[model samples]
Target chain A: MSESNEEKKDEIQLIFGDKRLDGRRFDELRNIKIEAGILKRADGSCYLEMGKNIVVAAVYGPREVHPRHLQNPSKAVIRYRYNMAPFSVEERKRPGPDRRSVEISKVSREALEAVIMKELFPRSGIDIFVEVLQADAGSRTACLNAASVALVDAGVPMKGMITSVAVAKADGVMVLDPMKEEDNYGEADIPFAFLIRGGKIESIALLQMDGRVTKDELREAFKLAKKGAMEIYKLQKEAIMKKYISESVENG
Target chain B: MRPIVLPGDLVATNPKVAGFGTYVENGKVYSKILGLLDKTETSVRIIPLKGRYIPSVGDVVIGIVREVSANGWNVDIYSPYQAFLPLSENPEFKPNKKPNEVLSIGDAIIAKVLNIDPKMKVTLTMKDKVCRSIRFGRIVFINPARVPRVIGKKGSMVKLLKSELGIQIIVGQNGLIWISGDRKKVSIGEEAIYVIEEEAHTDGLTDRITEFIKRRKSDVGIE
Candidate 1:
């Protein structure tokens, strides 16, 4: 069963990676689509779709902090959770939060908090929940991008938008926004976040590479990541603006 | 034509100064200055203004009756506002008709926004075509703000969800969703709802949803 499952996965990869069949470039990302303001129970929510990866994120509050221990008097707290559903991937993930997810949640919160003005909400905390409905290569990056858009849609103030992209070394060649196939068999995967306005790297969360790349290759990867981040930024801006325009019309 | 401000463009009245202009608001490529239409000490209204489907007086909305009263039904508008659909609003509602017969708890209906009083009371009427009863579907709740997202860009998302899952999905602007299909389709519909709810905070959500459906379809085959 395991062997056959592996073979099935391989077959799936071959089908998905048939760029000639799909007419896509190696470095090009799958079609990116975004929808903002998607959760009713939450303050802000958004849905992000990138190829075969589906991620939804909800932002609840700059409201009062719960349990007290997590609260900070000097600044607002930011809580982030990155979770994958049991059936999100081909191999089902366990329901409860895992160590890797928890770690990713912490790093993601830190990265996002750097862009948010915690001083504005003092003592309050913003809770961000990201749910992965499907998994491809760069779920984390997708989550970050979606969370930023949701925050903006919720009218949360920030210095600038936070956008992320993944760079990986696949088949001994560096690629931008590597797909599921590239990520499974690829050597390196680096997901980095950037501030949209100034185009500065805000944080690098998960950087793993089976093999080392030259200094020039690393720089080139960073450059590609930045480019991808900008594109994501454009999509985020468009989503927010679309909401605003429609909202204004409704108000009128 | 005035310079169109793309979604992320930074524009100021004075070209020489940097970082002073109003940031372009959502979905608008360019907004003309066209002189200020109205100005207050703290707020101003500009031209080429955009529109949204916010709840307003007389607007029709789909709602679920969450609670029932002798005189009226309490409707969950799926918005920031709650609505009361009075018995008088239902023309066909016989006095002898049990509230369940007219509209039961969890029954979805189209309701018209009658009056949103200063006290925040939302009065609704079931006197419109869209205000009639909804049949054979499950009601789902979403964030009011995310309604557009679920609908997608020009109705693409809803279309895709309906086609892929083979479900009839009706999305109310107030965040109420009614979905009907076969058992498998209904389960898929529920999963799609959760998908929308979970990923509502992200951009590029449609691609993810499509990918999710595709992956899930393959998974079921594998099982």
Candidate 2:
């Protein structure tokens, strides 16, 4: 028997049988690649790719804070700018800091500030620039990941690294790392950034959500996101360490 | 070789005092930077592999005079903080002489960090015997964190380079190495310093540097 017209019309098959539209399981994440110390001019730099999202982060300072007035007597201020290239999206995004970019920049700065030992460099500033050359669904999370790696690569003191990922509900099914199309049509999207210490989540640096999910569904999504973050954290470490390891080999 | 550690890695447990580049938390010591874990008898520290120079009292740094004010000179030590060389602290200060006469803009001086206030104002002085102005030399820059390795154990690596290349080198705490000698030897010295900076973490660096100098001399058909 065929389903009713109303039910058939409302149902979108984001999940085909057991696999998602991209032939991935609900718990699968997009392929991620991270590299550190790519920019010689920057104090530290990282280049990362998550699915179709490409992010590059450059860190400068614990240096003097300019404009004089921005100097904080008790701690260094983090100046973060999140920018998307004009050609990043399907339609050319306008250049400069749009409302969404400014908000993301602020939140990402605050997220990194939680782990950074800013008090060590009082009256100074740390400038972090995350540029998205390609944008997909979870560009914000990807930016945070790259920024943290760059900060560490710069040898900035921090209590821990920040790992970020998103979990979404597509077609009534919870999925990890929603792709672009799924994010556009997803029922709920929740992104999280965690500071892990001693193999445990020491704190949640960022938490944001769009759309709706049940209380139980939110908890499940957080667990799923944490798993994805842990995996990404390992990659971040590998990327940072690879710089030194390769140098040793090549020079030897 | 010591194990490489990242930020948040547990470096030591209780009873081991946390030293530089590390912090103590809940009776355990953890690294606060990306570096190599250094464990001593009574303390655990992390030697950072790369970073900007942080000024402290007693560090001899190579600073370029950026501005010459009436009372003092503003020096750029390549650190985040702006360093000042007061006229009185410059050993050559005379009541009748102006600060610019003693050290004008663009002069490079080897000075000691006299003091660093809580606000990060670095005060430098040319009062020490080793402090002087650079008249002629080439400065090679490296990561400040690798300064200790270039210095080696009690000046052994420096001695090797000096004796082998027949060049004069002054390793700055701020990572600006000054090399002065025959033009060819000076350039070779600069390259050797970079090799040391690049492979700072590895062992037997002294031997490798000696071999490198030999190879370079032969390649250039110099002694």
Predictions' DockQ, in order: 0.02, 0.56
> lDDT tens digits, residues B94-200, model 2?
99887878788999988999999998889999999888888898888899998988888999888988998888888889998888999988888888889988788
TM-score of each: 0.52, 0.95
Q: Candidate 1, overall lDDT? A: 0.68
lDDT of 2: 0.88
Candidate 2 Cα outliers beyond 4 Å, as residue runs = A1-12, A246-252
> Per-residue lDDT for A184 in model 2?
84
- Candidate 2 lands at a TM-score of 0.95
For candidate 1, lDDT tens digit of each residue in B96-202? Answer: 78766788898878778988765346899878765678877687866554566678779898999988877887777677777887766767767876787655545
What does candidate 1's lDDT look like per residue over A1-252, in tens digits?
A: 012213343434322343522455545667899998878767778999988889999987666577778777677789999999999989878897999889888878888887776765555678899999999878988899899877765655565677888887655556788787767766667777876543334455345444567777788788888778777777876776676542333221
- Best-matching candidate per lDDT: 2
- After TM-score superposition, the amount by which residue A149's alpha carbon in candidate 2 deviates from its true location, in angstroms, is 0.6
